[model samples]
Target: MAGDGVRGQETAVLAGGPADGMRITVADRPAVLQVTRPCVVEVPFGDVRVDGLYVYRRDLRVDEEPLRYGFDPASP
Candidate 1:
């Protein structure tokens, strides 16, 4: 079980298999996704269903440098 301020509350349970790779059910939904590769699963806010699943492959490339973040002493 996990709680997120932006996502409200969510309970993720591994329906079967090991922790390394398995199907996870989010919010007790019927749709279960097998996490075999690197990807990002997006679900609608305050909803149990998965809105989208984006898979990251090796073919993808990053041509531009990512933005850097610096620590701010003023921020608590």
Candidate 2:
């Protein structure tokens, strides 16, 4: 659900879990990340496909054009 006329924007690519491959619209890419959010999205996993909240956190690596996020299962 990308919007039009987004200023100084870059793609924040969500990795793993339900939001996998999901792109988030955000403000301009900064040299260092300041603002961030936790993944409260729930998804079905395992053989039972029971819905579980799979939190997401930023990957520790060099920042690229599109910011990448990985699953943070420990987050509550």
Candidate 3:
């Protein structure tokens, strides 16, 4: 989840899909944001009552050039 200062805050993210090339927008007010990587994640074969799932990968991209901060699941 990505957010501003404090322990609890709102977050948002832009997610993408694998085969279908679908995009998901995550906006959680007063909560946390979750972005699921399509290729690395395992989606259920059938209709599942879950948003999405991602496999923990060490090679995950954290930040882009000029951006000091990086994307770390352990952080926030």
Candidate 4:
């Protein structure tokens, strides 16, 4: 499971939006997040929790390269 994807409490990069390229702490393994009430994740900047839409795009073993949220505007 070392290179299968991002594990819990790991830093992942934001795919888009204002948080794009920003790093955040992943609270859940497999990165399962609700798009409806979207979970608040802790960003590296002052550990502030940002509220936004996060969709699971893929899994990566590399740090700061994995996408925590794709934030597709077309999605409902």
C-alpha lDDT of residue 69 in model 3 = 19
lDDT of model number 4: 0.52
What are the RMSDs of all candidates, in order? 19.7, 10.0, 10.1, 10.1
Give me the candidate number with maximum TM-score.
2
What is the lDDT for 12 in model 1? Answer: 37
Q: What is the lDDT for 52 in model 3?
A: 43
**lDDT at position 71, candidate 1:** 21
Per-residue lDDT of model 4, residues 1-76, tens digit only: 4887645565666566444566666654444433434455655668565556545443445435344555455543
Output the lDDT of residue 76, model 4: 38
The residue pairs found clashing in candidate 3 are none
lDDT for every model? 0.29, 0.59, 0.31, 0.52
Give per-residue CA lDDT, model 3, range 1-76, as digits (tens): 3565333322223332221222222222222223454343376667544444432222225332211212334532
Winner on TM-score between 3 and 4 is 4
Give the better candidate number (1 or 3) by lDDT.
3
TM-score of each: 0.21, 0.49, 0.21, 0.38
- The lowest-lDDT stretch of 10 consecutive residues in candidate 1 is 56-65
Worst 10-residue lDDT window for candidate 2 reads: 30-39
What is the model-wide C-alpha lDDT for candidate 2? 0.59
Error of 4 at 4 (Å): 18
Q: How do these models rank on lDDT, best leading?
A: 2, 4, 3, 1
Q: To one decimal, what is the Cα RMSD in angstroms of model 3 from the true structure?
A: 10.1
Per-residue lDDT of candidate 2, residues 1-75 (tens digit): 258544576677777766778887657543332223444446644544424455667664837657777756566
